[model samples]
Target: MIRILLFSGLFTVIITAVQLSLNYQKETEELQTISQQLAETNAPSLARALWELNATKANDIGIYLMRIGLFKSITIKNENGDTMVFLGEKDIEAHQTSIKLQFEYSGRTGTVGTFEYQIVTDIVKRKIKDDFIIILISQFIKTFFVSIFILFIIHKLVIRHLNEISNWLNNFKPESSFSPLALEADKGSSNEMVKLKSAISEMGQQVHKHSTGLEKVVAERTAELEKLAYTDSLTGVTNRGAFLQAANEELNRSRRLSYDVGVMMLDLDHFKAINDTYGHDAGDKVLKQVSQAMANCLRKEDTLGRIGGEEFAVITPGADKRGMHKLASRLQQAIAILNFSFLPDNKNITVSIGYTKVSNDEDFKAALKRADEHLYTAKASGRNTFITDKGFLPRIVS
Candidate 1:
């Protein structure tokens, strides 16, 4: 806003200056033209009237010249230096800075009288104000529209995309492969983060020979624990390890870039009731279906894992409060659309979600706890709703 105002102010000043210059030039030329016409026509007629001593004709001529609205004062005099008629407000002596027109006889035999007039600056300035305002408004409107266009282009092509890429890099891990980002526009762009990941993977393979004896056994055991830590054996999605690793990487990157990271905690609603009513086989089928349904809603860059038997975690890099809410809503809808067939009658599945964002000042762990608290609030308030940093989810009527 300040920039727009400054731009408008400078433009107006420059235009006003040019307008004043043109007004002065036009007024000067107009004054000179009118002086020539009056000398040729009015002066001869007035000289005839004066020679015949006709007061009425001289008075009419004086009044007509005054009504022209250009002159502030008009003085008429005879050859004897005696004023015949002075019809004006000011009575200043005619000298320099005044226009003097000397009248002559029918054929310039002798001088009859002189008409002296002065121009008004205030009148010229008043006329210029209208054009001045029009020019100012036109320039201001043009600047306003152009500024809006520039901001829109910057936001669409630069700001939004840059923030999105920064977030993707924050969530990326050296151990993981380069996956497609969430943004459809970014799908074709092979970013630096992917190259870095490829390089790290190649380096890890080269160092594989160092694992020998105790080192080999320890590595094997560690790999087993890591595999168990991140993946749910039944669902085959991300495990706790995947969620934690991504979250940690995002937090570390966010600290440097000052980008916001969002995380969601989701729990399957009434899963125990489904298990108690049906067998363990039915429960497993429902769990797999629920995970798959939610996964369909997520982007390739997003992380979704079964952290526990009935609870899942999602990490969204580069999401603010609104972004977190939007993702949560989509996941809720995906879960709502699923249908279960193992039961005697068809049943619908619903999940409650909690969401929070890690800002520049926060760590990922604190943000996770806040999200969990909101999740607990969501579960306590109702069974199948989402609670976010903003508030509880609004119920959709449709």
Candidate 2:
């Protein structure tokens, strides 16, 4: 851009110089022709012809010839190496130079002279010079303003957009938050810069899409891993580890909010006997049926887990001692009503259940232990019955 502006300035100067030089030369030629005619004739004819030349024309011719000598620094001279007229600043002694002229007449020829003179009173030279100066100054001013305008446009529209793109690319980072680039397209230009911005926008979109896809893949893999870690292989419910973790979380929430929580420990009565008599396949079927029944009985927020061989644990949030009693009885009755082919002879089966409400000072592990103790008590009293914590105070109907 700078180079273009500079070249324009230089071009203007050269053109101005050429135009001024050409006008001066053309005017000077006409003046020389008139001067030669003057030199050809006698004095009376010369004087008459000179008088017939209008004042304006004479003044114009004199000024035109003078400016040629003035600008070129050359005086008009005759053949005899004498000055006919001189114009401009005269310092011709440096070169000791003169000009040549040929004089002609109707019947004879003559010689004229040349000499250096410092004075320049010719009006045409001054006017031409003044006009040339005005033109040159005007062109220079125009060129300067044009250059400034072009530079300003380049900085504002081109340089500014490139700077913004560079900064965005440099600072780009991947995170949960998404960053977007939305630069405005050029209004009417179809230049290389516009194409480049379009390409960059395309690349940004592709990169963003790729990042989003990778994040989704990673999330899916994480979910798969969590499912494998927490689920039971045979029962399709939570494993012991997940059950404990879930119960602990629920217990903590209950404690913080002063809410009641209950735990139930259930075991299929004579489960080992059934497995031994009817094979493990029948035992597995019975386990699946019991798990489905528990799932049907539990709410969405309630948790159930397979803790051991034919034994299950349940966590009920916001359930007090009375609620625990009712839930345990229901679970026992549901199991009693279940008829499984565990013996291969198609005999009915039942489950013993024990439940306990979480106390304010007790943790999940302690509460679960108490529920286990109650489970053993129920098994000792009878194989297919349920027992709650009779020691719990003020049992209300759940």
Cα RMSD of predicted structure 1: 29.1
Task: Write one digit per residue (lDDT tens) for candidate 1, span 1-398.
Answer: 57866876797779777977798779866875675476456877777777887867877898888788656666677766677777767735532133334445455677666666665445666767766777777877777778788776666556666676567667655444445455344444444544544554455444443433447688889987877777788997888877788888878887788776788999988889888988788889988988898888888878887888889989887776656677787888888777766654456888888887776777777888888898889999987888886543444445
Winner by lDDT: 1
Instruction: Mark the regions of model 2 whose C-alpha exceeds 4 Å error after superposition.
Output: 1-191, 222-238, 245-260, 272-285, 299-301, 317-322, 336-345, 358-360, 380-382, 388-398
Which candidate gets the maximum TM-score versus the true structure?
2
Instruction: Output the worst ten-in-a-row residue range by lDDT, candidate 2.
Output: 40-49
lDDT of 2 by residue, 1-398 (tens): 76877798789979987987788777666655554443332233322323343334333444464554433343544445544344456543433332223345566654433322232225457767897889978998899898889777886768867876787777665443545655566664436666677677678767878888988999999988898799998989999999999998898888888888888899899989878888899889989988988888888989999999999999999886666667776776676678764343455678888888888888789989988998899899977877777776346554
Error of 2 at 112 (Å): 45
State every prediction's TM-score relative to the real structure.
Answer: 0.41, 0.49
The TM-score that candidate 2 achieves is 0.49
- What's the number of clashes in each of the models? 3, 7
